[model samples]
Target: MRLKDPMKRLNAGLLIIAFVLSLFAGRLVQLQGIDSGKYEALAMDQRLRRIELPAVRGTITDASGRPLALTQEARGVFADPSLIDPAKRTEVAARLSSMLGLDVQKVLEAISTPDSRYVVLAHSVTPEKGRLVLSLGYRGIGVVPESRRSYPSDAVAANVVGFVNQAGDGGAGLEYAQNKLLKGVPGWQRVEISAGDGQHIPMGEGQTQEPVPGQGLRLHLDQDIQWEAQTALADAVKEFKAESGTVVVMTPDGRVLAMASVPTFDPNEYAKADSSELQNRVVQEAFEPGSTGKVITAGALLEEGLVTPESTFDVPDHLWKYDKKFKDSHEHETYKNITFGGILAKSSNVGTIMASENLPDDKLYNYLTAFGFGAETGVGLPGETRGLLHPPSTWSGTDRYPISFGQTVSVNSLQMASVYATIANGGVRVTPTLVAGTLDEDGAFTAAPAPASRRVISEATSHQLIRMLEGAVGREGTAPAAQIPGYRVAGKTGTAERYVEKAGGYKGYTASFAGMAPADDPQLVVQVVLQDPKKKYYGGDTAAPVFQKVMSFALKSRKVPPTGTVAPTLKMFAD
Candidate 1:
């Protein structure tokens, strides 16, 4: 090898240094001047990643703090499609399918998508399954922890509390109506990005923002009382062979303690049931109230000072005029002149019409409106109906006559309950409430206030009406089965012929019983209705027994003290 001179070596070193400097300068210019925006964006993309954190939904509790609906932590499985190898897609999908019960082919297709970076394998998988999947040490598999809405009471207040969909949105009942209050805000997180396959890398910014959970709801439903009502209503439906049935129990102050409908559906399995079964019939379905509406008619008449409890009427069996023959549900070969109280106790249509004949159509309509008829209660529920009560001006001659006996008009079970509640609470009509309060994410209570009441009848008139109703449950009156052993229950029984849309006439019947217990100091009002009972269709036989079972349990559960030692006056008809 030829030895180079020292000058040549020094020159070569300088040139090498120049070359290195130029290369470095070119790189600096490319980063800072030519593509500065791209470099800045790459730096930010490495330092941050937007991630959505769902808010926790609140609990739904009954009056006694029993949870009817609640939330539980669940994990959602997802796959990093870009990181998953095309060859192993089938294998990975098969493993996940076996574990999560997902379709293997579908999952494989999802993970093998060319442009997609992520795919959700399953949602709401149990903790055990999630842990098993996590232990697999798969590079592309990931999990996002989430909260799922659950019904602890299951079918128990299904229609009232309602349910949430997969997207965690409210669908019906209080859930849909109060969505704004129930659904809380969501939050987000950020993370670093790495080189090559765009993988997440930790950069010390720690979970960027903590998620805020959803608010809770407190309902006026008493779980025990609700159970009582449901049991009774279900039994009535089966025993009477009814198409459907509804029962409503509320406090004298208008808080709905319990509302049950037979042929009810479970919220968890709501998708499997018919739309009709999901409805709250107490507020939805309307029926001709029959003799039970005598209470309202009596209220109107007494409030206007048109009749007294002791007033006598020489009522005949057949009112031939108006093409309407008024007859008692029970036959009387030899009718006797009875007192106003007797007429009501026997539920005579002639007596009721005679009493209502003097009141103007305007007065009747006004009273009905005051009692919350032909109007929605404005409860926070989905599809609340304003029942059909035709304007009094539309009343025909026969229509007027039949309306006096609750034939032409239609009212819901809830409205019927409120009518008795109004009488029980000294003629003050209060709006019914389902939810008691809402609890914010911070555990602060935002309670709903009790509805205001309007007086529709005098205290004296209310008391007089109670006395007359007392006679209806006494000896020589109908609804003898409604008599409880220890408590003094006063109520009315109704058997209305259901109108047939196809036939354009009345064919079937709806048996109903509406009353307030203990008559002296009313604590609760309950209504029971059975539609289209087979074999026996009388309200006294078909519906009254169901009321007895529920009322007995309700009195015991609420610890309502008995008013007197006197037993319910038993009545019997001659064989």
Candidate 2:
């Protein structure tokens, strides 16, 4: 009986062994054939890592090819939180915090996040610092290629060049206006990694998509001129105890050589700048333009044959209109007959209104529009105000009278400068431009389209207006201080009652001077505006000196030889 039981047990054991072997063979077949693709995909998903390849940003250069704003090579530090040990996270965070200048609690929170697979520790890390971070050999830590924006000229042209944000996006100025052209496409790379340590596997399968670099911008801004203008504007703003100031220097054909705004910020440290300091006030803010706008009235009168440089008007100390009494800057006895050129030279508000009384309202408004008022100059800058100009239809009962004498109408600095630029360029108004052209990745420059131009008045009328403006810089003129030594200077002074929004009314003066050098043969136009200056609010007293300083520098820098011709004498009061 015992021998028979032993044989039965042996047979049962053999049967069980055969069934277990069959199960193992079937499982092997499923793994190797039926479900092989699914398993292999899961394994690859766990081992493969993707690294971003950041594209190089473009450079912004000045007219002389000097770098103003540029991008430098940098690094982005990251971590795989899932691969870091939970117990070692605190120690890792402490080490990283000390090396990277990060708060330990922030680092710990980042590394200990629940269900987080990846996290960024820092961006824009220097290459040396990045290499030091890598040398720590901490598991789950990695460094990727990135970029950082740099402003070499700093605040020199910061208001014009603008700045980029932490995300590498253009935040303001030309940067925001031309972001798409300045920011290029980014690429990536896929590589196999060691699952045990979260490190790149040497000689592992890898693929790459190379990045395309961004195109660069070449501006018409001359760095040297920009520096000089900025320095001068800053000094004037401080000296005058003014709220703010702006200076724009351009060629007769509308090529902006330098555009500077006081209280500007450095693009490198833009985050700390006040919002007001970031604005490009030259094109963004508008004012009444004061006597500087008299050139338009003079142009209108001359074009209609209503007056000439020698024409005479009855001079009065004050003239009463509908609701306002207009007078010159100073009170004096009425002169019997003041020459038309003398009215502008003396900057007499009553004289300007009296001279333009014969002109039709529509003709005056048409001339204003023709001279580039009430419109954007298309200067290629953002936040440009078209300025306030009530049409003839919208004019109030007394609007026509004030509008004629450069009151009740609004214009930006660039617009007023272009007005003088028109007369300077043979009566043609050229659209102002700051960008000279763009450079491709290969460094080939394609010049920007030529500035648009249209004649606003006859060449003869422009010449007559130029002669009248020259009188404004004469010894008896208001802006005599604007005269540059050895140069035939011509310019106009402006002192308008500035409207203050916080006070909700006009409280202070906007003093300004718009001028051109070598008036006989003009080459450069410089416009200076000081807002709400204290002590001396007259344009002649405050703004003209700034004009002289910047104009002298620009004229000498451009090598514009003086015509050496003496200005013609104009009769101020009739004999």
Sum up the clashes in candidate 2.
Answer: 0
Please list the C-alpha lDDT of all candidates, in the order they appear.
Answer: 0.80, 0.89
Question: Cα deviation in Å at residue 344, candidate 1?
Answer: 1.9
TM-score of 1: 0.88
Model 1 backbone overlap count: 2
Best by TM-score: 2
Across residues 1-575, which tens digit of lDDT does each residue of candidate 2 receive? 36568889899889999999999989988998899999988888777777777677788999989999888988888888888988899899999999988999999999888876568898888899999988988888877778888998889899999999977788999988888889888788887767766667768877889888888999989888888988888888888899999999999899999999988999988989999999999999998899899999999999999998888888888988877777778998886788999999999888888898899999999999999999999997889999989889988777887788788889988998899889999899999999999998888999999989999999999888888888899999998899888888889999999987789989899999999988889999999999999978999989999999998998888788889899888678778
Candidate 1 clash pair list: 56-213, 56-214
| Predicted candidate 1 versus true structure: per-residue lDDT over 203-306, tens digit per residue | 53436677677788888899988887888888778877889999888877789988898778888766677887888888878888998988878888888888
Query: What's the number of clashes in each of the models?
Result: 2, 0
Give RMSD (Å) of candidate 1 vs. truth.
4.0
